[model samples]
Target: MSKKMGLGKGLQALIPSYEDENKKTLRNITVADIKPNPKQPRQEMDKQKLQELADSIKEHGVVQPIVVREVPDGGYQLIAGERRWRACQLVNMDTIPAVVTEYTNIQAAEVALIENLQRENLNPLEEAVAYQSLINEFGLTQEELSKRVGKSRSYVANMLRLLALPDDVLALLSSGQISNGHARALLALDTDEKKIVAANEIIKKQLSVRETEKLVKELLQNKENRKKKNERAPEMEDLKDQLQGVFGTKVQIKTNSKGTGKLEIEFYNDDDLSRILEILLDDNSHVSRETN
Candidate 1:
């Protein structure tokens, strides 16, 4: 299914019990009689969202029953209907209608996740967590996930990487304090302190994502310069490494801390310089070195 049709996309158009001639009556099944699927991709929901769903359920009856798998323990394991289950509970419904199916753990998880994604129901965090779960729980690669969900591998990879963010940033994203683009800007920062500072600057300055990207680049460049200055002649040192690689000769760099540095491009005379120059400026490429 296309990711555009994520879990909630055509859910209303799905054959609801009301529309099915052979649909089971709205009957109450014991809450204890239902079991959570161990293979369920979505393990948690935001309390605020849950409450909101519950309020909606209180107003309109559960339009759909949950899908479940019968367990030997007399209860039914949830298959692909968590949203309906949660909403029903919010309205204090003791028993909910369920259609029990027999499926392996892997099959159940795949179905559940795909159904949710197709309906466009999972939020970004939930989607990431679900994708991560599908990988960790099922041993699927980003490429495989992309194939399954009809998304590009890069899209799957990037979404999965969102989980690498710190908790504070994740909270900001979940709470709508920052947009995904802003979070992407923070990801450019190499350290938590720097990222947090950038995040603060973003909120304070009301910078757009593009502006944040530019600001982060400038800050990173400044950081690199500070690091180089602390190490003295870092540009020459790096140049030595590069030139050595290019000319196959031991290159040396000499510098004095009095705001002066020298690039000792040691070479075996004329032929070495040719190779060095070629490596330095390959295919009209301009390699410029700067201290700051």
Candidate 2:
């Protein structure tokens, strides 16, 4: 991991926290008029958690306002504090207190990503998807993204790799059934079938992340061993070549682990068979020695 750069400079500072929102000059705007940010990286909000916050707001009221930008036509668009905005709505508030600002499209997206990251609101899968979306939509490199979000480059890169997982594994991750560590360890497996099998075992056995890593390592080692055993030796092919030359016919050799098997020589006609027999009898091959 790169050295911890405090999430406090440049674009990182653009994202407003609840405390920061409290400091800005607040404006009370109709909650219904304020629209959700199109660039918002958060896909969904937890209903139960939203209700808990709503309960807190009902008693104490909205202590910190949400931040918004003026729309070209009219009204405002949310830049951050979506959860606070939603909670106010749960309480049937007509207008929400907000701090108005101006932001470009890319700036809005950057703030949205950083805001969620700062609050730890996104799950592992959502965080990864958001990273990919920002990179795709705005053409930002992982290193650039890391600096923008104040994360290490490897942290951004590793998060992006979680997308390569199978749909089943992704579902497990999205639903909070498995952790990011478990999902990452499973990627070492090459086949979806093996990954799914491992995932099931993870859930069933209640395996920890370290246990999952060990399991996947063993599976990969076994796969490599099987591949080595299935490969044929070079000398086997050379022996088949010698047999074919001696008989002047198409020849094949098959053997078991015990080195006991059959040698096949193909002949189309009686003349061909006679020709092959003549060569075998004249040569110092095992068949001729046995006959003598």
Candidate 3:
């Protein structure tokens, strides 16, 4: 038998007794009477796509009933099919076929979130925000949340990480200047300044995701090299200060783990050099050094 197409885990499994035909919960409700879901996962809707949906609804009418919950004030708060509802409104639809169901705030929010995820309509940021909301308010673990949204655990975790990105980088992502892959590459950097700079480089160079990853790798390698070459040991600093104190002149010391180093003694003139030499000879300090 050919099965009907549906959402994550089947909407009926997610919600018990959803639109049981025998119950006769379906009705034509005034469009103005229904209110938007406060927990609508989709933050932005493309106007062109919405207009297209409106045209389709106009021609074929709503193929499925929208779900809503009647509030205490006798008004309806939409639980699912927000796009259809909005499309109907665009066409100045007076009423829509809705299944009035009894659901608590949590159930309504979950249904709305799953609907958006299954439809794959939300941008990365919007998806992250929705995931965060569910985890924060409902205390859902990533594993649990992934199953509900029909995504792998890694996908859900990666989406949550996007929330940690600085606002400007996120803006770059949200505005379509960079893709989620680009954003993931930025996450490898250790600081916000680096992330922002890399994001700008991505836009200016029009770098692809692979190129961005390579850029990030090179930046990190350079940083590591700098750290190794310029790293000043604490004992080296102490020796430099002591040498400066004894010679009455500035002293610089640099060394690596191999105990190879250089000692630079500043001198004002020949007199200063003679004084430094006298001190060094008196101490009989022996040293060997290598240039990095």
The TM-scores of all predictions, comma-separated, are 0.62, 0.74, 0.76
lDDT of 3: 0.84
Give the per-residue lDDT digits (tens) of candidate 3, residues 167-219.
99999888889999999999999999999999999999999999999999999
Give the winner by lDDT: 1 or 2.
Answer: 2
lDDT-wise, the better of 2 and 3 is: 3
Could you give candidate 1's per-residue lDDT for residues 76-148 as a string of tens digits?
7887778778777667778777755555665567667777777666666667887888888789988877766
Q: Tell me how far the alpha carbon of residue 249 in candidate 2 is from the true structure, in angstroms, after superposition.
A: 26
Each prediction's RMSD to truth: 12.0, 8.2, 6.0
**Poorest 10 consecutive residues by lDDT, candidate 2:** 283-292
Residue range with the least summed lDDT across 10 consecutive positions in model 3: 1-10
How would the candidate models be sorted by lDDT, starting from the highest?
3, 2, 1
Residue-level error in angstroms, candidate 3, position 60? 2.5
Please tell me which model should have the higher TM-score, number 1 or number 3. Answer: 3
What overall lDDT, based on C-alpha atoms, would model 1 receive against the true structure? 0.70
Query: Comparing 1 and 3 by lDDT, which wins?
Result: 3
Off by over 4 Å in 2: 1-12, 15-25, 233-292
